[model samples]
Each structure stands twice: as structure tokens, then as C-alpha cells.
Target: MGLGLATGMEFYTFDSVNLVLTDLTGTLGVSADEASWILTVYSCALFLGVPISIWMAGHFGYKRFLLGTVVAFAATSIGCSLAPDLDIMLFWRALQGLAAAGLVMWWRASVYLLMPKPQRSPSLMRISTMLYLSSAAGLLASGYITDHANWRLIFLPNLLYAAGALWLIARHFPNQPKPSAERLVSADWPGIVLLAIALIALQVILNRGEIDDWFGSAHLRILGFVGAGALILFIAWQMSAANRTPLLWLELMRDRNVLSSALLGVLTGMILSGSVFVLPEFLRNVASKTYSATQTGQIMCVYALTAAAIRPLMVGFIARVGQRKAIAFALVMLIMSMLIFNRLLTTGTPGWYFALPLVLYAFCLSPLLPAVGSGTVARIDQNKLLDGVSLYMTFRQFGASLGVALLTILISHRETLHSARLFDHVRHDNDVTRTWLSTVSGTLTTHGGYTPLEAQQASVRMLAEQGAHQAAAYAYADAFAFMAVVGIVALCLLPIVPPTPVQKK
Candidate 1:
């Protein structure tokens, strides 16, 4: 557990570097959409690597695998920090994703192997809490760093964290064989290749959709076919490999509970990540705060206190009220919270209004984190725990990816349409408006120390910026509308939450 907590510190490095992919267009020469490959590529690598990594862990000792992964993960971070170009940086990011694939699979398996059944949940919570805290820290801190200093500094801390994790595992963890108490899975290279192709191609298309203008662009058109073909091939491969070492364990996804859990995980990710993506921009531009200040403000919310304040209460609720009811109640809080936020948003609103909704939202989100995960993965066949955990983790990661892509696409489209509509009837001959803008421009120039033309340009820039934000406000509201729909849909699936857990074998 200490090792888990120690290894989790790398999660903190995000506070330092989280916005690199988002802001890289301004920082690098790539197009806004092209820069997103950095994110999608990593996800693809992780999806491809998970199964293979799990299989290898069985042959090698547990500590040995964890230590190697830590080293590889850290080394890639160093490469990412020093990357001279976008393409190079993306390569390093993908490598990190591949190497960082199964840290948790091994950790969970080891815990169950080493510890008693009754002791497992608490130990798992310790690790989960560490991750939750680290993530909160990373997002807020990384926001401040990106605003004030350099983005590369974010990657530096991960190096240290990985080193510490390596030292801990090397010194304390025992070198033990993979338990044969459960059934052993056979390898399926053909299915693995097909699945990798499907994920990579599909992720590429989704990641590039917004920037490439979706199907309108030639790049997306080609990738769409590539993705479609891969899916077809993967489906065929799975059909034929049902009893063999299939790329996907064909029977696992067929389980009603497992399918619902995966979908629920996806939905959970979609909302959580959309908020993360939109919040910083909203605070910095719409809320009239500096980048660093915007980030600092979020830390004061209930998100920072979730593991400490929320989790214990949730555990109690589940123990007393029951899991399904607790989850349902939490979902209610989430929807109500979002509604509160949507209602309060206007041209100008106070910070307290934001806080009220955020607290409610985080409170609702808290229980689902543990409840959803524990419910989804715990009941699976013990031997296949590695695969089950890997799938769940992949689903969770993919949710964030989907959220970022969808939010970005929607935000850009809405902003453009609204900004265009705002000045549709404007004329250069409107003296009052022109005079006001000219005066505003002149005053800005004199106060800001620019030439007349330069001041006018600056004023124009400001106008465009304001217009963009106005557009974002609308997009954000719509995004929440979509989120509410998602929440409703997920809630409707409440029947998926069984009265008791799946019977563990």
C-alpha cells in the first residue's frame, strides 16, 4: 500500500504538465487538431499494450515487471521533456502509454495474492485515495505552471516519482511466480493485431475529427475506412477465435453486468473529463481570472476533499443504505448540481454560485468512483482479473479521451457559429458603434503603449477573444445539456446495478 501511494506520486506530475496537448498549437507548429494525436496515440498504445503486458507479468516475477515498467515509464517522461518537435514528443508519449500499461493489473493481483480477502478493500482504498488526491493536485498545479512557467516542468516530477516507485518495489516487493490457482489464458496474436488496428484507427479518426473537419477532410475520409475495415476484421477474428486465445475474451463482454459496467464507466469518464476540459478555460476567460488564479480556485472545492470527506461517507452509505440506492442518490446529486450550474451561468456571476454547484457535483461524483469500479471488476473470475482490470482501465481512459474530443469539437463549432452571427448585420458606417470602438481602441493604445493601427488591431483581437468566449458560454451550456441527457440515460440503466454483487467464483 505504501508502494502504491509512493508510485501514485507520478499522478501529481499532471499538475505541472496537463495542458501541453491542448495548448501545444500555440507552443508548437502543428495544427490544433494535429496536436491531439499526442493524446490519441498514447491511448492507442495503452489499449494495445494491456493484454500483452498482463501475459508477460505471468512469466516474469511481479516485482521485476513493476520495476521495469516504472523505469521505462520514467525514461519516456525524460524523452517527452526534451522532445524538440511535436512528432518526437508524440512518439515519447505513446511509448510511455505502452510501458505504463499494466501497473495496476500487477498491483491488484499482487494484493489479492499476498493479503487476506477481508483486508483487500481497505488496502485498495488506500491506493485509490492516493490516485484521487494526486490527480486533483496535478490538474490544479499543472494549470498554474502552464500559465506562469514552462509546460516541460510537468514531465520532470514524473521522473522522480517513477524512481521512487522503482526503489520501493525493488526493496520491499517479493519476487514471486504468477499463481496457478486460476485458469491460464492462451495467447492470440492474430486477434491482438486486429484489435490493435481497430483501436488505433478508430482513435485516430476520433482524435482528428474536430481539426480535420470530420468527414469533410481527406485525412478523416481515409482513416474512417481504415477504422471501419479494422473493426470488421476484428469482429471476424473474434467470431473465429471464441474458444482460443482471443484478442478479446469473447465471453467476458457478454456478461450483462460487465457490459453495463463498461458502458457506465465510459459515461462516467465522459462527464468527469468534459468538466476538466471546460473548467479551466471557463475560469480563465469567462470568469475574468488569471490562469494561475483560475487553477488555484478549483482546489478550494470539494474535489480536493473527495477521498477524505466523501469516500468514508460513501462507504457508510453503501453499508447502511445499499450500493444501488447510494449510486442512484449520487446520480441525483450530480444532475441537480449540473442544473444549478447551468441555471446560474449568465453574462456575469459570482464565485459562490460556481462553488455551490461544484460541491454538489463532486459530492455526487464521489461514491460512483469506488462503487462503480468495485462493482464492475471484483466479481470476475480471479484468474482473469488481470484482463478484467485492464478492460475496465481502458474503458476509463477512453472516456477521458472521448470527452476531450467531443467537448473540443462542440466548443469550436458553437463558438464559430455564434461569433459569426453576433455581427451579421454590422456596417462600417455605424458611427456610434464605430466611434465607441475607435475610442476604445485609442484609449487602449494610449494606455497600453501601441501605435494607432496597433491599438486598433489589439482592440479587434480583444473583440474576437470576447466573442469566442461568448460562444464558449453557449457551448458549455449545451455541453451540460448533453451531460444531463447522458446522466438520465445512465440513470435509466440503474436496473443494471444488481441488488447484490455478481457471485464471485
Candidate 2:
């Protein structure tokens, strides 16, 4: 329970600030793009911290490491709340991400390490539910806070979550002996440096790619080569014989189950994170009737709530049908949900119209992570479980970064394409365009108390804005279609995932 709360708090802090970015921008006297660095830095730091935490846990003991991270997380939360400017806030946010990485990774790895094989599934389910609820609540809470109170208040709730998690850990968690100096000296410093360079470069590219015009910009072009080269070198260095102490054990990927699970993690992360990013933007900006942040939060909550509700049934379902078949079924459902979004979503669609598809998406997504995680953990050597878990999570984070970057670019390109095509049809020579403009101009003249010349300019401006909105809607629909295609690719990979071992009752 304590572990779950700590994990929940990490996810909540990560997600809650998303809705409050505008508030941060206004208060900190930064541009919207600058404020986004708050999130970008956190994600990058979290990714970098995952394997390091695994290494530290091995030497320092999981109990002591977890407690330290929990304290740091709480302290950083307070720091974030008290930060007077963007630079200070980002510094604290990065530290918070590092603390979160340790807390989340160790807590999850501990579940597998401590639980009996049969009990692992249920335990993971409970933790995942906490994740779902807390993540959903973050959006809701942040939206409300931004609307009614100070944006800094968003970070304060982590304090209470941290306090509860601290009590639970101190009371119930077991203690371990101190670390050996021999093991401490064997750290893979080279591999760590390479990994950091790769992750930092990749994160910068993903976060700033669109703003920098991608490879069109000389800086991004340089970053692209550096990031790609670093990743290649990092992979080679990890697999080489010269490294005595490897940060990440690449040999784990030799197991078919582990490899498949990692791939599944990537696919799930891509779709899940991509949709989370897209939906709110759709509601607030692209839709005909814009929704407030609170309203958008309410709509998104349906997805998390429905997933949490159905998680128990997933354990039984996976047990009965096995992991491969269960994931295959879920992938099909995921594709279906994406198609539904692609087909039904439009500028004029109502919020209620999304409820069914969101529920369906939740059902499809709930079974995936736990099912794949349990299968991977059960198959790996117990001693290497932490390595496997960290690697899998790192892949998922990479996938999330890729998805957001890809979709951002896709939306921008498609919106431009769609707007151009729309404008092409709005010419004076087009009969339909002329009639519509005349109607709107006449209406504005009569109802808005405008002169003829004023009404003509206003009607043209309204027409251009409407065209922009429709183009955005079309672009979002294309994004969903792309997700559906990604889902199909995931479905194709299900065959490679080994069947879950049948546990004797």
C-alpha cells in the first residue's frame, strides 16, 4: 500500500502539471515553449535515473534507497511550490523526476522480488489501479487549482502523499545490511556517461524538434547525428566484453519473452501517451465548442476510471486465455478504439460522444502492462529482475517521447496541408465560397449592426478561422488513424510473446 501511494504520487505530479503549463507561463514570465521545459526536463531526468536507481538499489539496499528517494521527492515537491522563477522551478522539477524514478522503479521491482509468483498478478493490479486513479486525479486537481487557486499549490499535494508513504514504508518495510565497498567500486562509469549523453540528446531533440523545424535547423541536425551516434555507441559498449560492470544487462534481451514484453511496452506507451496528449488539445482548441481544463479533465477521467474498474477481471481473463491471446484481443480492441476516434471525432462532436470509445480504450489498455510485466518477470532470472524492469521502463519512456514528437510533427504538417487545401476552395471564383461569404456578411450586417464594408472583412476573418479549426480537427483525426496503424503493428507482434506459464492451483 505504501509503495502504491508513492508510485501514485510520482505519476500524479508528472501528469498534474501538464494542465497548468499556461498558468506557469503567465506567472513565470516565460513563453509557453519555455514553460514546457519544466515537463521535458522531468521526463529526461526520470529516464536517466531509472538504471542508476537500479544500480544504487543493488549496492545500498532497496529499503534505504526507497526511503531516501521518498524524502527527496517530498523535499523537491516543496521546492517546486516555492520556486520564484522558471529556472528554479525547473531545477527542482528535475530533482523531483530523479527521486520519482527511484521510487517508482524500486517499488515495482520490490513487488516482483517479494511476492510469491501466484500473488504477483493481483499485487500489480492494485498498484496499477492506484496509478490510474492518481493520474486521473492529477488532471482534475490541477485544473481546479489553476482555475481557482495558485498554480504552485499543485505540487503541495505530493507532501501529503509522501507523508503517508513514509509512514507505511518505515512501519512495514524490512531493513537491509549496509553495502560493501567492493561492489561500490565496480560501477560502470563509461556506460553511464554514454547513456546520459544519448538520453539527453534524444530528449532535447524530441522536445524541441518541431520548434526548431526538425532537421531543417542546423542545431537539430547536429543533435540528430550526436544522439543517434551516441545511442549506437552506447549499445555497442554495453554488449562488449571489456565492460566488467554493465549498467544495463543487455543479455536479458536474448530471452524471447523479455524482448516481446519490452516491445509491447513501447507500443503501449506510444498509444497511451499519444492519446493523452492529443485528446485534451482536441477538446480545448480544435473542437467547435472549447472545453475548460476542468471539463477536459472530467472527460479524460472516464478513461482512467474505466480502466481501474476492469483491472481485476483482466487477471482472470489473462489466466484463462494466456498472455499472448489476451494481448492479441486487447490489441484488436485498441485498434477498434482508435478507429472509432478517427471516424467519429469532428470539430462539432460533443464530449458525451467520446464516453463509449474511452471506456473501450481503457478496457483494451488495462490488461496490457500488467500482463506483459508479469510474463516478463516470471520468465527472467530472479536476480536480474530489476535490470529487466528498468530496461522495459526505459523503452516505454523512449516510446512515449517518440510518440509525442511524431504526433506533434504529424499534426503540424497535416494541419498545414489541410488548411492549404481548404483555402484553395475558398477563392472568389468558387460559387459555394461566394454564396457562404455573402450569407455571413449579410447576417453580420443585419444582426451585428455592422456596415457593409466592416461586415465583409469580418465575414472573411470568420471564414478563415473556421477553416483553421476544421483543418485542426482533420489533423487530429489523422493522428488517431496513425495510432490505429500503430495498434495493428502491435497486434502483429503478439505472436512473438510466449504464452504465460500455467500455474497449478
Please name the candidate that would achieve the greatest TM-score relative to the true structure.
2
Candidate 2 residue pairs in backbone clash? none
Cα lDDT for residue 289, candidate 2: 92
lDDT of 1 by residue, 225-255 (tens): 8878877877787667343555455467766
Question: Model 2 over residues 87-116: C-alpha lDDT tens digits?
Answer: 999899889888888976777788887888
- lDDT against the true structure, each candidate: 0.65, 0.82
RMSD of each: 4.0, 2.4
lDDT of 2: 0.82
Model 1 TM: 0.85
Least accurate 10 contiguous residues by lDDT in model 1: 13-22
> Which window of ten consecutive residues has the lowest lDDT sum in model 2?
176-185
